[model samples]
Target: MIDLQTKLVGLIGKPLEHSLSPWMHNETYTRLGLNMAYLPIEVLENDLETVINGIRKMNFIGFNVTIPHKISIIPYLDDIDPLAKQIGSVNTITCCNGFLKGYNTDGEGFVSYLETSQGINCSDKVFLIMGSGGASRAIAMTLAARKAKKIYLFNRTIEKAKQLASEIMSYYDCICQAKNLDDTTLKALIKKADVLINTTSVGLYPNIDQTPVKYDLLSSHLIVADIIYNPLHTRLLQEAKEKGCGIVTGEGMFVNQGAKAFAIWTKQPAPYSMMKRVLEEKLI
Candidate 1:
């Protein structure tokens, strides 16, 4: 346990006190008898470059990116996965031969969770995604790639939403619409959406009382999802469940994404079930 040969992997971003990634990954490593340890490092915006440089010289297998750092970390990477490049976000990174390559597992993770756990396919679903950040870019692009019928993006800044929608429409055969967070527009779009996802940090830990969408808007037919797992059931998911809507929490995505990153780092199939169990045990 105190050996110097233990390899390291971790998550790098600000406000990491709420992250369960270390628990999920470390448990998987323990069960598999892998000499690996996971850590969480909170890096400020200005110190991101310094931290990345330090990680490059250290004994790091790789690390996961989150929140504000996902997009910003791209410039520091040696290479990027084609899909992650297209999505303009990087959530996972693998270091090999002193070279750091970035990849975005968020979209694939969300898609996997949606199909297996929620029993929903992207092809026939119309999605309304809240927030236009890195996570939004990854999820929207992935859904469009899967041939989602239509996608609506709502964000505080209309331009970012439009930019992401335009990027999706340019590369994928999907009808992607973007708009400002207007009540009337949200109401009309929610009525047509089959799945509603919250990719914002509004309902994350410490700010547990905040929510991105109005509670009254959730309908019984919609499958509502939030990507904030710390609370398990966020205000959005709680309201959606109370309104009789189907619900998907952030845990599925978190576990799925971490599993993918694990495989990338170890060159072995990740123990997905065990990873999921670890996160659920802590979160649920």
Candidate 2:
């Protein structure tokens, strides 16, 4: 049990009913005997400013930003972390000296998980990213910073994908290109990709049938990753596994990112083992 006077923290996003952040953070806080509570604040687009301003006046210590608010919350922040600025998104926010500072723990979380769990150094790998949204930007920027040999982005909208590629190229020396996910182009790209990542909402809940790439295009040499953890193993990951490709689930990303946010909020090393145990228990 934690001290009753512990601080409050939480996640802010629309439709946060499915979030596991509260469970993970509160469990850690209890395990450490810290006085903190994590909650979920579901806010729509119009309520964004109101919610942020309210956080300032509340007893909240910090909050994790998610989904639609990741990029939209940037303008409301007092300051942004350089990495978050570069990635053009913020997933972690902390109150420091009466100011809210935004940070992008997603990139660091992805890189850390890759190194620690998969032993896969992204530096020399060719990355084919699917999506042009906030998650894709963070993942693409991290891959470029890690010295990925080449990074290709495929999105339904060619212009959006190109825009993301342009932004990433400004800071890192990498061959970044964008492609439209036509049947022909997608098949060709998947055949050549060493690491294929789905950063889009494809294969997520309510749209589990939709996958960014065709399964027939995948090969054993590919390392397939989908950032959809709700179903544990997305159809994309399951199909890739059937093809003998290495698979990485979104749970790894969720745990790592949450751990980073927990560390930032408490200024203490995250209780990763305890956190993971809590997550597993909730999942079961």
Candidate 3:
């Protein structure tokens, strides 16, 4: 029953072909009897500003940001949440009275997934995060804020990882280190890590065969997590399982994040169970 009164929400990013956000959000809306709809809008980097300007003039409640646009979209928004500003990325945006605000739900969402679903506490754990992108920044900052004992950031570009680590060290009382993606460093750091998270798009859909870390680096004591939910079982998770490592799929973070974003937009508790079921069904 979509009409002029329906509140529209969207996911804005490129290569949204594999996104499960629309299904998850719309199912929750249907179950809750909300007059809302979620759509996926594929927009390239060059057209982000133009698309955002168009959204402002429409009846949109809010939208989710992803991938290449997360960091770049900051300037276009009217305001930014403190956490998102600090993390240097924006994954969620809200619109009210024609004013758009940005937020980074990725970190909080991932932490919620780890704490609630996996029973992992950040206070005493050592984390090895791969990548320095939007998702990576959010997760690292969140973990640091949670009093994680140590965080090691690894990325293709050492400087980016170093910058993130420096920020975490300056703001939080945590041991943060940054390193270039090398076999020697990975071998050493992974031995000391309790959790290894992949925030990179290496194992995303269409390139499902690629992985960020070598299979041999995984161990029984490590909990490997990936943020790429499209494939459900990425090659990194697959190999981690084979090596007797505990694997946390991207679905938990995806659902938890969507739940948070839903609450932000609707000003009500999200239907987590329904959203999780819908996302799991789509992935299956």
Candidate 4:
């Protein structure tokens, strides 16, 4: 059905061989009867500028940004949405008539996932985040804006966590603390945390056994959330479940963000259910 009129959209990132965005977006387009094609484009860091310039010249509707490009791509963009600007990261982009605008759906999308799946509010909640990357930054900023009581961050590099905590505290007026991840500190923090978020790729596919925290430390009162969708159920979630703790996978986060991007590109209500189902099937 593709003709001269068919539109093209894609995801751009290094190591995109594992991405499910193409399957999810293309299936959604098919079900909605939209003449748009979605695919994954692997672009190395050094080639980002050239690729971006090519995007400007092409007839592409838009493309999703990922990994190292999220933060680094900001300068090349013509404009950036407020949320993306504040987070200093962009995961979604809108390309229209040579004008490229960047936006970050990660914050709202993750919050939406939390609300939809757990019926939980970030207001006055205590969170333990296990990373200081772009994903962690967006999630932290959004949770802070939600007026979360406290966000305890732990990263392999303590300085990165401290920097994120300082930014979150200064920008959003929330209490954020940076701490080193160790058996002693993790156990203490878990006892007080209402939720634990894994923003890293520890339990991602091909390394399914790696977990950020030991399941033995988990409690029934804690809610474990991970941002890896390939496996649907990460080792962290499995361990959380073993302790009768509430758990959420990254599937909802991934789908919710895609829904936001879909709306941005098409100016139509995304087929949310179909997109999620497509992703689920692909993950399985």
Candidate 5:
């Protein structure tokens, strides 16, 4: 049912061949009877300028950004949401009359998922986040915005973790500090934190057995979350649940993020259930 009249939206990043966004977004459009096509346009770092220029010339509604472009896309955008500005990254973009507006929905998506899927609230909760990459940045920024009481951030590289913690401390009133993953102090903090989030790719496909922390170290009092959805249930999550800890999978964040993007582009309610099903089907 697609034609020249179909509105165009897509993703821009190198190595986009591995992205499942097109499948999830296209299925949503088709299921909703909307004439829109979401494509995965791989644009290398050197070609970002050209691709952005082309987006302005075309009839594109909006698109998503990934990897290297998230922060780099800032100057090119006509406007930016405050959340995106604070996170120092942009993932969703809206085009209006050739004007591009940048947004970072990753944090919103993650927060919304925790709230609706697990009855978790950011305020007054202590978070123990593993990793200091883009995913962790978004989640940490969002939690800070939501007024989380404290966050004990951990990373293999202490400097990277400290940098992120410094940013949070500079901007928010929350008690955020960096700690070493192998440190006895961080391990003690984890046992008492309200939530434990694994934002690293250690538990991803091929490394299915790898986890940020040992399973026996997990506490039943903590709500564990891993932001790797490929296997649906990572080893950390399996171990957490087995020890009677509540767990949140990466699937909720993945689906909710796209749902936010869909809402942004269409200005309508996304079929949340179907979007979840589409990705679940792909994983299976």
Candidate 6:
């Protein structure tokens, strides 16, 4: 009883079996009575070009990129959204008029979710971001653009952190600094931070016990946010919560970013309630 005329949309990445995009998008399609099917395409690093070309040739309307492919797929794209280009990564892509255009909804989604869900204003907050990967870049840049008082990035590797911080400072003309993730420095940063965000994949499903920062570094004054949703409540967030700090999970970011991407492709408002319900059902 399935429609033969359904359009195709999906996510492309290596090891995509763990993704929740298909469920999220399919639920929206079913609720809205749209003839669309979302899929997860497991693409290998060596076969990125071939997979992209294949998608272009097929009837797929769009696709989401994740992990190792986010930045690497940029050069293969025919066009890139300015914001995505500035962020140096793309998590969403749309096919229009036979051309693939890349976009980074992660930043917009993260900022919007923080404002609406937590009600934590970013105007003058000193934000401390852990990790210097794509998600960190997007979040840091968004905070800087919003005129955050100051932004600091901590990473195990000093050079990588410094590089990301320098880029943000240059791009946004804001006070951005990078530091090595040492006990003393982390303790100091945690004490002074109003909002602490983790953009690394440390506490994801398979590695649920690991947290980038120690529990001793956390304080009740800090607002901790983790971008890992699979296990939902990460150890870092749990510890922060135990310390009475406000916490936000990665689920908000996932839903918001997916909604934004859906809007970009369909040119309509996403059914947020339906999307969230579907995810909850699956999680249960």
| lDDT-sorted candidate list, best first | 3, 1, 4, 5, 6, 2
Per residue, candidate 5 scores C-alpha lDDT tens digits across 150-206 of 998899998988999999888899889899878577668976799999999988988
Question: In model 3, which regions exceed 4 Å deviation?
Answer: none
lDDT of each: 0.90, 0.86, 0.91, 0.90, 0.90, 0.87
Top candidate when judged by lDDT against the true structure = 3
How many Å off is the CA of 90 in candidate 4? 0.6
- In terms of lDDT, the poorest run of 10 residues in model 1 is 275-284
| True-structure RMSD for candidate 2 | 1.6
Which has the higher lDDT value, candidate number 2 or candidate number 6? 6
Model 4 C-alpha lDDT per residue in residues 1-284, reported as the tens digit of each score: 77779888999998887778888898888888889998788989999999999989887888899887898899899999987888889999999987899999998899889977998888868999999989999999989888998999999999999999998887887899999979899999999999999998798888999999987788999989999886888999999998999899898999999999999998989788989888878777
Poorest stretch of ten by lDDT in candidate 6:
1-10
TM accuracy, model 5 = 0.97
Candidate 3, residue 28: lDDT: 79
- Per-residue lDDT for 1-284 in model 6, tens only? 24667778889887877788888888778888898888888888999999988888877778899988999999999999887988899999998655899999998888889878888678878999999888988888888888888999988777988998888888786899998888899898787889999998888888899998898889999889998898889999999999999999888888889999889888898877778778878776
By the TM-score metric, which is better: model 2 or model 6? 6
